[model samples]
Target: MNERVTPEPQRRRRRPTKQGIVLSQQLIIDTALRLVGQQGAGALTVRRLGISLGADPSAVYRYFRSTDDLLLAIADELIGRAQQGWQPTGDWRADLRAIGLRIHANYQAHPQAAMLAAHRTTGRTHEIAAVEAILGILRTAGFPGPEAVRIYHAFVDQSLGFAALDAAALALPAAARTADLQVWQASYARLDAATHPHITATAHLLATDMRRSGYPYALDLLLDAAEARLRAAG
Candidate 1:
């Protein structure tokens, strides 16, 4: 008779980090957002995240293959936040306006993260959901398939482009931001009428309007055009 063969033991799972905190994908993303907000996007390295989470730097690799993967996840998270609690109002124009405003506000809320992520294509869950929702709205509005796609493309790019611009301004140093905001009043308002007739004429209005975001007006113009297109299609 032969002796019974012994079975090999399975490998043990990795335990919690030194701080006794369990790591999850959501947690990592939240921590990264916080770090970026507190410092800047450059502060979101593996080592920095490890320190923040009190885990091994390599632990982040277990969840994300690389920092770029993590950044994509962060970008997707922003989309997810923007879509949170949002329900389509059945009026296509109203729904589109709400969606665009939500995206812009969320990005503005997280300026540093927005600066890094506004232009990224995550192709992840949240981003895909947003695309599906917008496309559905356009198609439901009686837009043809190709037309719906074109409108969706323009709407998304316009929202992201303005968000990035606004975020960049928000991310500047406090003093610099103040100076930039004051330029219209201090410099443009003082321009000689002869040398800059148009600017000088509009200086007061420019001082007021330039301080506010042009996104809302631009968004309305786009929607107005789409409305006209629908009417013309009829």
Candidate 2:
């Protein structure tokens, strides 16, 4: 007996409405990002997106079968934005550092988008290209294949993991963010040396430095360890 095969779903083609506005995939994704940026992640619903785009909510379904599909596209767009105009210098370590920082900065700029895309995999063009680019950097660095793959995995994972975390913090309300900063200044800074000796010892530095993002320092540490590994392999 022959088995019947299920037909693949066809993609919907978009056309101009009576209102004379044409909706493209890029417009939908860009509008979604702007909506999140302006009103926070909670504001991203099909209705709100349609309102922002000045179209009917059902129009979105033409391009994206579901909200999840739209979000994945938005995630890929963030990756695309990060890679724009980024050139890799020949120095492997330097190139890795630059790419990592670029990715982090783009995600930081769109914290709400970053949070939405954090755990999800787009498996789209931009993301695939980024993976290839990073792996190529490792291969060019003279690390053996297995070692290069391991390092690449760690580098990308650490970068995205931190980006997600920092994005969450960035997405906090204005008052909440202020309160977090004030905690380090007013609360941690005021701790008694005798009570919390370690924190109190670094209290001055904490009040001054803790307010700044530490991802750069963390990246340096990872690179430093990788360099040490390269030296040991020599």
Candidate 3:
């Protein structure tokens, strides 16, 4: 004797539009990235996303449970992009520096996208892979498991923290960005040695360096500190 099997009903999902663009999680994430790149993070609401996708606002909920979920996806996307084509050299410091710079550049490329989610730990595949890579670099550099984890935490946190700060500046309106640029030249450059000797002495360096992301130099400093600790423990 055979028993009849009952099929489970599926949840209702928004259908694709007349133009034939399917509504998938990747589509939503890509659309969200485009929205962020073009209009900044403030434009990433469900209504706005739906309008961008030409679907109902609820359609996005089918993929991401909330805005936070969408942001995490975006963050993972950023990490995946950064890690693309990355090759590791035997020199752990150089390899790690390359990764740090790539991550920083990726964030700068999509300033609003970074601002949306750089600080959060997405715990997704890409994020986990990045964490593993960094930890591996530290471990290869002779740091023990606990030491590697500690350095990895500091390295990643500091990198993303700088990325967020720099992205915030980049995400500013054109006029504001220009005004900020002008300040280093106009204000700092003009300061007399008597009033602000340090500023006067390093005004040129400040003007040149402040206009760019300082992540590379900062990463070097961080790597140096970690190296010192590693040597001290030996």
Candidate 4:
């Protein structure tokens, strides 16, 4: 006769959760980036992000010292993606142009993040690294110390300024966008009718390609100048 043997219940091991307090910071930043992409930076707030993430509002504070800290993180993320796999090409102008275009395109991809990062410099690690890289490249090109600094400042200003302007334009209401277009169109139409040689004579050609050669053309022109300067010095 076998005695009834009742096996004791085995204790279940707790499966690891992908999301928890450990992920809270990354989650908040990711959610913030999404909201920023859709709505624009103005709509991004700690409280709002917390609500969206179902986390405590102050939980962000644990990772970021302040809202500015969070914004810098967002900037690093936005700008950092373009910098993935980026390496020095030794040709200063070419490298610089590549960097400028990459940075600009990255901002354009995320207009809200662009708008936020454009104005706020939290001195985040990536931001500093970008600056240092530019300076190093300029030095490699044999730019004088002062000249390198000047050109670096101008280069950064151009990239960030244009990105901010573009992001702001994209954020405008449809009516505002239309109005902006129409105003420029009307100005060109009026210019076309002017009798002055400088004003009306070239207006047809000038007004036709308002955005045709756009920012890339301008960037190319700038690169050409920088290249010329480098060649002259060499």
> Each candidate: what lDDT?
0.90, 0.84, 0.85, 0.72
Off by over 4 Å in 3: 1-15
In model 1, state the lDDT of residue 140.
92
TM-score of each: 0.93, 0.89, 0.89, 0.80
Please give the clash total of every predicted structure, in order: 0, 0, 0, 0
Which model scores highest in TM-score? 1
Q: Write the per-residue lDDT of candidate 2 for residues 120-217, one digit (tens) a residue.
A: 78999999999899889888887889988899888888888889989998899889988988898789878888899999888888887867778888
Off by over 4 Å in 1: 1-14
Residue-wise C-alpha lDDT for candidate 3, range 60-170, written one tens digit per residue: 666776787788999999999999999999898899899989999999899999988888888999999998888888888899999898888888888899999999998
Mark the 10 consecutive residues where model 1 has the least summed lDDT.
1-10
Candidate closer to the true structure by TM-score (higher is better), 2 or 3? 2
lDDT of 4 by residue, 1-234 (tens): 122222333221133223433434456678888988877766578787766666655555556666776777888777677787898888888899999888888888887788778877757677888989999999888988998888888788888888778777776787997677665457855754445657566666666665332667767876777778877988
lDDT of 2 at 84: 96
TM-score (C-alpha, index-matched) for candidate 3: 0.89
**Count of backbone collisions within predicted model 4:** 0
Q: Point out the higher-scoring one by lDDT: 1 or 2.
A: 1
Pull out the clashing pairs in model 2. Answer: none
